[model samples]
Target: MSLTAGILAGAAGTTALNIAGYLDMTVRGRPASVLPARAAGELAERAGADLGSGETADSRREGLGALLGYATGLAVGGLYGLLAGDRRLPPPVAALGLSAMAMAASVTPLTALRLTDPRDWSASSWVSDIVPHLAYGLTAATVYDRLTRL
Candidate 1:
């Protein structure tokens, strides 16, 4: 596939994955609302600390940054699939790669803020967070494959 084809396919895949995640989070009664003001404020402060002197928090910038991240992930994943030379890289490996990519995307919000460390996660954390990532990966691959095959 060409770059454009890869990107379009990836955008569709990621959007589907995100929709599924949003629905699952809703069903599980997870926090759908944005973080509270106080938490957001703290996070902004923490994120600002690494900036050079005179740096300050910009909520709009942070939000834009998050948007860029999603864009980047879609681009990266699509290119990766393209470079794999066959969108048909065996199901198991594709599933695992997709799972890893999804998890990488999932952890971005916190990781971007240096808020949470995956290595510090507990068994339950792995089960709850990681398992969902795996499911999303499998689902995303299935969706992409189905679409491209048509």
Candidate 2:
């Protein structure tokens, strides 16, 4: 039950994150990031899996990247459920913790692949990165709390 609730919460949170990102793009007129696809391609190459050439490869990478993001969100949510069980943390703590965990999970791989370095990000870049995660955290925490309240 907890796991199910967490996963549903995660789905909601992921949706919120995506909406926030799209809104940011609309407001700022910035292009979408290709880092996710690049990360997927790099990992696939490292694992000795060929994704093919030309447009097909690009499409595959994009699809894989999206799937990877979903997987990360769901896995994180499942972990949260397992950890929290029937207990509820304070709202702020849950939000911060979940946001930090998701951010770390997403960023660590890119950093490891030398794809990005958050330490050198500009203020605006940091803001762009963080705001969406905060949305995810807040939504996920709220949903989880509501669903688990008995």
Steric clash pairs (candidate 1): none
* Tens digit per residue, CA lDDT, model 1, 6-41: 565556556655675576677776663232222354
Q: lDDT per residue, candidate 2, 1-150, as tens digits?
A: 989988988888888888998999999999988989999999999999999999999999999999988888887788888898898799999999889888888899999999999989999988888999999899999999999996
> Would you give me the overall lDDT of model 2?
0.90
Output the worst ten-in-a-row residue range by lDDT, candidate 1.
Answer: 49-58
Candidate 2, residue 131: Cα displacement in angstroms equals 0.3
**Segments in model 2 whose C-alpha atoms lie over 4 Å from true places:** none
The Cα RMSD of model 1 versus the native structure comes to: 5.7
Q: Which window of 10 residues has the lowest lDDT sum in candidate 2?
A: 70-79
Candidate with the greatest lDDT versus the true structure: 2
Q: Go through the candidates in order and give each one's C-alpha lDDT.
A: 0.58, 0.90
Q: Looking at candidate 1, what is the lDDT of residue 93?
A: 80
